[model samples]
Target: MTAEIDRRSILQVIGIGGGIAFLAGCGAGRTEPAQTEGTSAGISFRDQQGRTITFERPVTSVVTIPMPAASLLVAVDGGADHLAAMHNASWVAMRDGILGTMFPQALELPHEIATQDFTPNVESVRALNPDVVIQWSDAQLVAPLENAGLKVIGLVNNGKQEDVDAWIAMFSAMLGKPERATEIKDHSDRELAEVKELAAGRSGPGPSILYFNRFVGGLKAAAAKTYNDFYIKLIGGSNPATGEDPLPGTGMVGLDVEQVLSWDPEVILLGNFDGAMPQDVYDDPVWKNVAAVRSRRVYKVPLGGYRWDPPGQESPLMWHWLGDIAFPQEQSGLRGKTTDYYRMLYNYRPTNADLDRILWTEQNRQSADYQQFNAG
Candidate 1:
């Protein structure tokens, strides 16, 4: 078993240091904040510290301080269009498929700004004159941005229900898109309801699910309540680490080897994101003794839109992905049939070529390690 990753390492993995360090620039406020016309559509939220904050209109001239926040904003609207700069340049590169042909402007962002680290050239962000800047819960740093007279929104990507709902609702309300907020809330409610309905009276101890991610020499399973764990539950699967500490947004906890062997999950859904397949693990002697491996119930989670990123209201696609992987009999061409799901959930359909292009890009995921995650 490998040792679990520490908080510092996790930050590094997300690209907060070294070559992706912050760039120097002036901190003077460049743009004035504007209030939206109406109040009916606005939503008020209390932050983790319990201060009331109001969102009156959609944020314009957005700056993506972190990668996950960038993905979330993009899902809500053309955040990339508002993005004056970013911390991760890799996300914009053509090879990554995150910026894509549609958002060519994203590629033009200043080179000094990359990744989510605050180390980027401050001058670039100041020059863009953004109305809002999105960052994580780092209060100390976020305070300075607020002091600079920038409206800062903190996003939680840990995947907890409370955190997720608040993030979505607040953003939607602030963006003056109550319809979009309602859309996300409705979809989330439906998915949770369906999960409860399907799991009702299913009998026996529930199937165990774990998220295997690279750590020391092997892999570590995320705790329950992490986004990975939440997604499993959203699809009617169970994670044995229900009693573990909660990770916001993601709803995940750390799992040690001993704990994994103790739970000995019957059904394993290996993320295997970086070209690591379930078969690869099952073929190895180490995993052969696991119940899931022996039963041949271990499966690979797809790396497309549904897998790596927060499906957001886009969770309807999660159902399709789950059905294809866990219940192939129900696949019914849903994976390839983009129209119905796209329309029902997102209320729009990409051209067949759009669908084809998206799927095709996924085929060559290994060409770049960040490609799958950056695809949102």
Candidate 2:
């Protein structure tokens, strides 16, 4: 939290150390933060923090300090025209992830607005002259930015499915696209429901799944009540990581080597946050006896507009990816859904190679049931 990621490298630094070291609870922000006033014509509304913000006219420019907000802004606004500046971590998400492909101009935008821990770079953000600043609701984070007289749209996400809806609604309203917000919600609802419906069909207890937000520094698992665990349980899978103590506000907990062996999850998922990959786990003798490793069922979560491990615009896709392996019996259209999702949201379809990259095909091809994701 004390460090500042250098802005020159184009996403070399991630806010939580690497891939969203922070929790999505493993789902999208569960509720909406910013709300539109009266009708489509209203200019006043409350943010998730319940603070009222009234714009004299339309919002023409925005500075986003939260990591996911930048890509989300591009997604709801359908372009990069309104974004003035973003956090360095946000830049890494797009430049290294699929959002960069959808909006290349975003890659060139200024990302010196905040430090790695989301401390607002008041001078830089002020110079950007944005109409409003979108940031997290943490008092420590929001106080300085607000103290500078910046009209901040502070967001609070609880990692619920409604959180993603609220984000789409908030961004759409900010963009003056009420219809677009409805479209985004409908799409999210349809897909999320589809995954849930299919997951409900399975009768038996699903495989024991474990997700590691970070693996190299030590073992960190997505504990219960987090977005990560939410999706795991939502998809009918069991999370052995729940019930243990979690680091407050972060939504994950640390575990000793013996603790992991005790759970011995049937399927292991490597988060995009850390440098650890399938090979790292495969090579580690400590994990060899684990059921997931023995069965070769470990996988690296996919990264789309935002890291799939945490909630973002592409969260439903994360569910399908999990279903592809954990419930291999299902005819999960991993490829088609991704292609269709991109087309529906960005109006740009991905090629087979692009889908392959998003799904980590090259790295996960050898994992058990991974072939289920192949273009069939």
Candidate 3:
């Protein structure tokens, strides 16, 4: 661990707001000094906010701020080894290794910084002196790092297409790993292509779904186009509040009783929080009148993987879950086949346990049956 000066230079770095330092790659085989007065020597690319961010070469001493952003990095290069630090300190040390075990190249990188939000560690970040920092949609966080004389870039991994693509591309541009980025993006695109082809001609009665989970308050629905919506769309399901605009960053879609009654979807799906499902909805006279309850079409989505939480970028678990719902024939050890699919698509092999752990976890299993509403 390199200890840096806590003097004015450190203070000067964080004093300015929104002024991020950037790098330019100097090409392979040429050793150049790390820092120049203004910019680095390498390639430049446009970031999601349409700002021009340049890199001096594949960034080695790197820090990842958000949990979702880390996947894009890992997708681009063998990101695990290059990571000098991360902001998702809660589970990165424990679960990331297990997840990284799925990829042969993504080795364990020791963290230089701790804390889930990265807010408490300016002095610590300065001490580690990472070459670049990657954050997914926290500009407020960026301002402080920019002030600290660090190169900070933004990534979007909150389950939106635009964000996912931009973040992946940014990683490609910064790491000199365009090929890897393209490979992953292409694989994602291809998966959707198959999904589209499957749904192109057929229009089935949309499965009514709900995503109620334990929040700080009571239960809440996952908003549209959020990771929830992404998987729902992939599996050809319908959210009861389908037409409402999705909230940014949070992806929450607010719903009330009238909205649920108006949609009257046939199926209801709930997130398994604390191993408890809202079965009382069937007993409630008002909810029993709803179509889903009357028709006895309700299901529970399994909750597993870092329990007591929703599934997002951290778990590839959702894909298997979606596949189970979308294409049953593909479900018999499909993730094992995913290893081959990745090899065919990405030229990388995924281990069996990686596929298994990602698939059959408690997070993937809900209650054995939907407690039919049976109102009428």
C-alpha lDDT values of all predictions: 0.49, 0.73, 0.49
Q: Cα RMSD (Å) between model 3 and the true structure?
A: 11.3
Segments in model 1 whose C-alpha atoms lie over 4 Å from true places: 1-58, 87-124, 215-218, 243-259, 272-275, 305-311, 323-338, 341-376
* RMSD to the hidden true structure, all candidates: 11.3, 8.7, 11.3
Rank list by TM-score:
2, 1, 3
Q: How much does candidate 3 score in TM-score?
A: 0.65
Better of 1 and 2 by TM-score: 2
lDDT agreement of model 1 with the native: 0.49
Candidate 3, position 138, lDDT:
57
Candidate 2 lowest-lDDT run of ten: 5-14
Error of 2 at 275 (Å): 2.0
Runs of candidate 2 exceeding 4 Å displacement: 1-42, 243-250
Write the residue-wise lDDT of candidate 2 on 2-50 in tens digits.
Answer: 0111111000101221111111111132322322234323355445555
Q: Please give the lDDT score at residue 119 for candidate 2.
A: 86
Q: Which has the greatest lDDT? A: 2
Top-TM-score structure, candidate number: 2
